[model samples]
Target: MTSIDASKLKLPLQMLLMGSATKLVAPKTKTVFIEDLPPEEVAKHAPEPAGLVNLGNTCYLNSVVQCMRSIPQLRSGLRAYVPPPRSANSLAAGTASSSPLLLSSLRDLFESLDRTTNAVPPSNFVMATKIAFPQFAQTGPRGQPMQQDAEEFYSNLLTVAGGEMRGNCLTAGLTGGQSAASAPTPEELDGAENLADALFGMKMEETLTCDEFSSAETAAAASSDAMDIDNNTALVEPPVTSYDLHRKLVCNIQGGSDASAQVNVNHLSEGIALSLSGKITKHSEILNRDAVWTRTQRIARLPPVIVVQFGRFYWKATPDSQDHAGVKCKVMKPVAFNGTFDVYEFCNEKNSKGLEEVERCSSSGGRRPYRQKAQGRR
Candidate 1:
């Protein structure tokens, strides 16, 4: 065997060894930072618009948030709100027990949405809301998505927002001459105050009457004496009544084919009418034990904003279920409505004629009718 000298290796073998060594070493890669790109390019590459994480079935919350955001007054008010400072007690609780944190989170969420065109995931807002109101944190059996009523969620949100406003008002009032001196007066604060009132308040009058029967002794005495005494009657005074801004209008869809019949075509107006003149039956707490009928009627005042909630969900008997009770289901029928409607027709008699006169004058003057887009759930 002939041994080859170490320095005398073949050129082809040496070249092959060098190539293998180069293959063993990894090549350097170039780093690209977002800062190095153009502003427009950076925006294009930004993370997809934030969207709500579907933590379980949170569609109910998402829907309510969308609807609430549509209200310009609410949006403006919430935007201007600055949450109160956290307290030591609240800090000890380890979570926000008041509206401050929740409102802050909401403000952050709204800002995020405004900054980005895409819908952001309201994870922080949702968590804050859940902490403030535990009912929203409830889960269905086996950790399933729970279904919630949109109206209920809306009510809860309004309650929180209203509470915050009331608390702020009270604080301002109590801290008299400090910041209250500089605060807007009742006249100057009319805009936000009126908006709040219009969104949540209503005024009404209630008339109550009593029907009583004379006692046996009194009856016998009256009959024996043949005297006309008003002992069996009592004079009742009417009471002032107040109602919430949110109105629930119910539709009886049983045994109907047409849209008008399925849902009372006049539901919106009729509901207002009925609420203005509804009867209440109650047992009197007085010694006479009389039956009382209280009639409610709307006052001359009306709110700037009116929320009408259709009673679409009802409890019905479930077929093929022997042990279970009635199940609640939504009415899936469509109700037709126009772009504009005159609610003046449903106002009290005192206001109805006046509104009619105004309408006639406006129509004769060739002025355009006030057109409002009515929104409803089918």
Candidate 2:
């Protein structure tokens, strides 16, 4: 065989490489359509709300986003976000670019939900979020999509959104909206102390009292001198200091029934308030006491938004098997709730008294019937 010259083969090699590159970089195309309708017709018959396209097992994120969008205030505030500058050499500056990308993508996704007539995929938002938080960018061992806890996702989103809000507030103050004194510091942002106070904060006062018990020697001496001592004599310890904090109220479900139970949100709130008020036998490490009765009461205030989490899952011991010894099963009991209800009964005495008249009138005959609102089901 005749050997080809090296220079003669150079052009063919370059052409081959170019061809491979073209195949690797081919563009993907997607087609989208919108129905044509007159402005009046569109206004009269608004299109159904769009559903989110799940990316992998991202239904958890979609559920949270949908719920957040339902709140007009939060949706509007997020839409009005202004990203901070990324010029500083600090660690915060390093993350500024990625954070803004996630925020902007989220805003865009929300805007699309409002404008689009059909289901919209949040591909850009999901990708940007995954880039910002690498821990969430995980795949299953078998190459299937991984699942995430909805509560954890909600908490992370809140923290990120809170940071952005703090940044925006600081930028506004520096740009002449307010003085630097009014600007929130990084510590405040990290804990979201200010936002928590403004949105879901409540004031609670807790009281603790120590139970009196006679020592063994004192008890024996008292018994010996029982005839000489007065029967009305007794010793008492001072009450413990009252503790106060800004905290959110939590409602816990006590029991589950096989038959479907009608759950009233207001009733659940009342149960929490009542359960928190009673005394509990608690050991005090600081006071070196074996037993102490502690009581918690809601002195005043309630959050603008109340978060209720139903205890619907529990761990149950199953018969020992080869595959597993126990399993965590979800409660299948149906819980019915109304779209809106008054929670005045659960509030403190002062607050409940104020709402009694109004609530009584609105809830005449001890029953307030509510019409079911249409909701999109997955």
Candidate 3:
């Protein structure tokens, strides 16, 4: 390759460089080599008079510092950036010098990178120089982290502040002998009719997907008056919201706790829950035997749990008591019933000695023992 000899050629700005360097005007130079000046070394030799590095030296060294700081991560990544060997490699690639703004722009680039990216010197130094920085331009809405930050910020806020209610469930408190309506439980707010859910951080969804809308199909059935009216006598009680229900006494019977627990649904909503003990009877004895016969009389009889769930669902409560239907919303949670008894053939009862199979009485809403399959419920 053809080459120019540095020894014989006159360099530009030679006299102004004014540094200790071998200069000459000879021919047949043996070699040409690049001597890199470290940024620190250049800074050390900047001409004191110009208030800038030596114009020639300054350009080279300024190029080094400019290349070092141009990385957004480098300057603000730490209290002070120290370029690592990997960062210095960028200078060898000569990327920063292409732009005239390189030196003036580097320090400012570090200022607005994510604040979490900033740290103390040694740790920040490696992260800033060795890794590429994320684009954190604050120029437009798309460039900002508004969506991610708002979600994270609200999540943190909920953790600190309490009193968020979800659905009909309650984390309510028990108190003294005050009527449940106005009882002052801790964290209790007044009538739900008076409050808004958005105030509780329940942000509105802009659109409901098809599946979300379909979930409301069952909810519509639940929000009706069918369960409350007494024409159908059954034990299923209405469901409740946290606001309308309150604890009056502690009766810890089932759970081995003297903890008195019962939910009063005086102002019962569309939801209701009830427990009652009764005998469940099917209309025909033939239907029971036929169902059993069709199934090949499985195990000589039905496994008793099936019979009990059927009994509980079908039990006819005494019509005098109010039938409080559970809230139709999410009320489909199967009603809780303690089935601690086995089914008995109605004729096999010890309470009836020599009882007739069918006892008939006059039609004044009186008792006529019909041939019926009954499940004794409690």
Candidate 4:
């Protein structure tokens, strides 16, 4: 190689050589100090609501979950839920049930939806639902997931949620220094501690009266042969009153003899009233024979939230059909409902009085309603 002294070279040549040398080396990246940079004008945007992506034919699951998510109280309650502590004895015994896993999966799903605006794929939730409910795990002939009924799924989901809520309350009570001996019964806990029941349960009173038993003794005795009643059947038998707690109220869409008439809010109300109070023909032990039993139901305790499921699907007589000559059809009636639903008419005396008091306070601007007063930071 020919030895060249760069120091002996001309200034212009040296400058040219230096420029070429600089070109050969990598250029330094521009340093940007966060503080030195101009104040960033980040476009502030409100968080848009996140949605669930359908995992297979899982729109039923998505719809039901979204409906539950719409309830802020339920969401917050589930977030605060603490899973029951697994006993060493139980763990050593065998694998645990998948029931509690549904609640955890649901909580995680809600958290994920809350944290991001992106569409969340509910694969875990779908799997959890399948494990929790076998009915939801039904598949089509091609092995693809089937489209299940949303209403049925909703009921099942609530049932699972209620179970989880009970467990949560039980765990909380135990952890808070409460002993098993002093702990409240399941029925007591339902009204007091179970979050699901507190939100959606309705304590119903059903009074079943035997029509034949209400008649005069002479008339009853005369009609005894016709009704197949025993001659010694009591005429003044007391009405049988029973109580039950229901999570949802079903409203029949089709009512009365008119099938073509459009069902409105008034019709819906009538259907609910009928459901609450209906007549059934059955064998009555009090009458000692088959008779018409009139069942009247009243709401003893009303929940803060009420779910009214419209009975849309029904079996229609189809003479042309080969299978059982009947086909399942959906009533696509446009049900008109008001935003404000007054359940005072359906409430019992005590609940009605409480509602009246609430209305009176609300109208006078004296105090908040019972529901509002009971609401906490959550």
Candidate 5:
């Protein structure tokens, strides 16, 4: 055996240990594949876009957020949103100095998603959402988050976002130019002019007129019956006739008997038309007589975007089942629709005539028809 100098061995030992430590902490690199690239990268090469990570059973929330993010105007509005002060934010803001928790969380989430190529966890947003709306925090038997309806989340989020946007707009207006004396109260602010309304709100005029006065003879009969012989006093009024704005529309599912005749997108249009079409509803309030009323609705104004929710799940009668009451079942019907939908027929006289004029002008100008067609979506 030959004895070696300890000084020479010390340098070699230190170098070996240092090399191993560097290897342990160094970044690893692998061969890059186009197919395996993140969606943000793929989007540059293809049309693919990134997806969100499912936080528990938060697919409902993810779907709505993705849909909203797809809207350019909506994304721009949310990006521009500056959280109002705590005084203006009426929503649940955990801290006194913080903005509305849900809105702030949503804005932050969107920013994070736009910045990252990887799937976002949305954990903070989910926690903020659960704090703002306990309903979304529903727990299953195992104490995990339960699955929720997408439409319910969509509607609720829109309502909350709209309110916050409107409140912020009011605050901005006050701070920009309006004096405190001239500023309107929160109650006086218009609710129909928010970001949500600008992006997807629609106005509809609903007319409800009594059939009792529809004909001259029926009108005369009603008038005669309105007089009291003993008191010699007349009611001096007609059947209930009213008009108002409709904020929402409900589509009913309709189909034939055979399974092959299952409801489709056409059926959806028909259902909407049925609701807007004239229908006589029986009433028995006036003069102990069977009065009738005809109700109708027309599009007062159209929004830039339209949302169509299919009536998929329904409560079905299950007579022979153990429950023997009813069961919630999803409709297996295959609905088909083209890229464009013609809603010209559904508009009121003013809107219909306006569309016609626009079409004529466009044709005369050698441009594409100015017809507004709704994009069919599921």
Candidate 6:
């Protein structure tokens, strides 16, 4: 074989190796075809500009790049980051509308590419002012994205300041060509405002917890009505109305702690059912005769032997004034009411064993030490 030239081979080989190393280190554009990526994988990879910076290609993006280009299939990668518009609701964090500039840029680009115009992104304030509250804009000062009513005046002026109807603007239903009738006057508007304030302030229902009941302020409230009326006749007034009913809790829980849970609570699958209309009032009277909202004994001379009803049993009510004021009525095991609610489940029960015993005592002295022998449950 002929002797190789080392000087000639070394220069050629070194040039090739140095060029390869420089290509690996340099920030060269890495183009990817969307068709090459799986549809699901595109979202995972392309995502937004935040993820794009990791791909290292968000800056210097053209303001009006195509969504999908023809030649090498180039597209504005930033379009993927822009949020979806809402008239239709979506479970996305960027549901807040984008600025007008962003919308116009997107719309023109998409339309130029002959693509669908799905998103008309408006800022959150724009949505609130323009869409949710168009009437306010009709009354308040209007500027850019000018309403047609405001625009006619604007094109005439150099730059109008505070030029929208500040006075009360009105709209009337002219349709159906109604017979002569007068518009609602200023007196009606004042009444409407009062009604609005009342509605906004009202609460549907209220609840208090065990800790609330234990408060020193609440203890005074727990005092019997009779005592309160007698001691402070000038300050305390008679309970105008009262309702009551008695109900024995029949169902027993396997665990004592589970048994004592509030029956009305959301976690409980089974509910204490009662006749939806009159039952709560009837039950409330039997339990806490003094619960003013019940209205059961407000007029009547009170029935003897208030029966504690639950399921099939009418349990006995031994009149006692232990926890209550001296004036007592047959108290249900755990009575609850929210005006319209007929059944009350003692949400306050701490455990089940005590309740089970109470049920047995009330149920015509049914099984006293009711204990089931363990089978596979053991």
The lDDT for every candidate, in the order shown, is 0.54, 0.56, 0.25, 0.68, 0.62, 0.27
As for TM-score, the candidate ahead, 3 or 4, is 4
If ranked by TM-score, best first, what sequence of candidates would result?
4, 5, 1, 2, 6, 3
| Tens digits of per-residue lDDT for model 1, 1-378 | 988697967666634333443446445876778878765455456764334556667777776665555555556556556667777986888764557777678767766655544556888877887787788888877877576677776677766766675534433432332464555455433333433454444343344543332344434343323335354544232243443343323334432334433334344454445445544656544433335465655434344445556555656676789988778666665544456655554445655666667777774774232335345333
Model 1 ranges with Cα > 4 A deviation = 1-55, 94-96, 166-195, 206-267, 270-279, 284-287, 290-294, 297-300, 316-326, 349-371, 374-378
Model 6: per-residue Cα lDDT over 19-123, one tens digit each? 443435644776778767654455445434111111111111221122112111011222222333565453265454433334344334443333222222223
lDDT score, candidate 4, position 111: 76
Tens digit per residue, CA lDDT, model 3, 1-378: 899677887656344555656686567865632235544344435442112132211232222332333322223222232222334666778643222122123333333222122221222321232132222111245542221222222232223222222212121211122234543333333322111111221111111111111233433433243334333333222221111111111111221112322332221110111221112222212111211110000011111012111111112234465665332121112323322321222212321222222223354453343223222221
Compare candidates 2 and 6 on TM-score and give the better one: 2
Give the distance in Å from residue 307's predicted Cα in candidate 5 to where it truly belongs. Answer: 0.8
TM-score of each: 0.61, 0.60, 0.12, 0.70, 0.67, 0.16
Superior candidate under lDDT, 3 versus 6: 6
Full candidate order by lDDT, most accurate first: 4, 5, 2, 1, 6, 3
* Candidate 4 global lDDT: 0.68
Per-model root-mean-square deviation over C-alphas: 15.1, 19.4, 34.3, 12.3, 13.0, 26.2
**Model 3 superposed RMSD (Cα):** 34.3
lDDT of 2 by residue, 1-378 (tens): 988787756544644333443446545764422246643344335645567999889887788777666655455555557777666665556544576887788878888876655677999988987887776788888976688766666666666765565544433422335445665455433333434233434555565664433344443334332344433444233455453544334444333543333332234444465446666677543234456465656535554455444455556666776788778776555445457645554556765665665557783765342212223221
lDDT of 5: 0.62
Kindly state the number of residue pairs that clash in model 3. 27
Better of 2 and 5 by TM-score: 5
Choose the strongest candidate by lDDT: 4
Stretches > 4 Å off in candidate 6: 1-119, 124-190, 194-378
- Using lDDT as the yardstick, the better of models 1 and 2 is 2
In each prediction, how many residue pairs overlap at the backbone (N, C-alpha, C within less than 3 A)? 5, 0, 27, 0, 0, 19
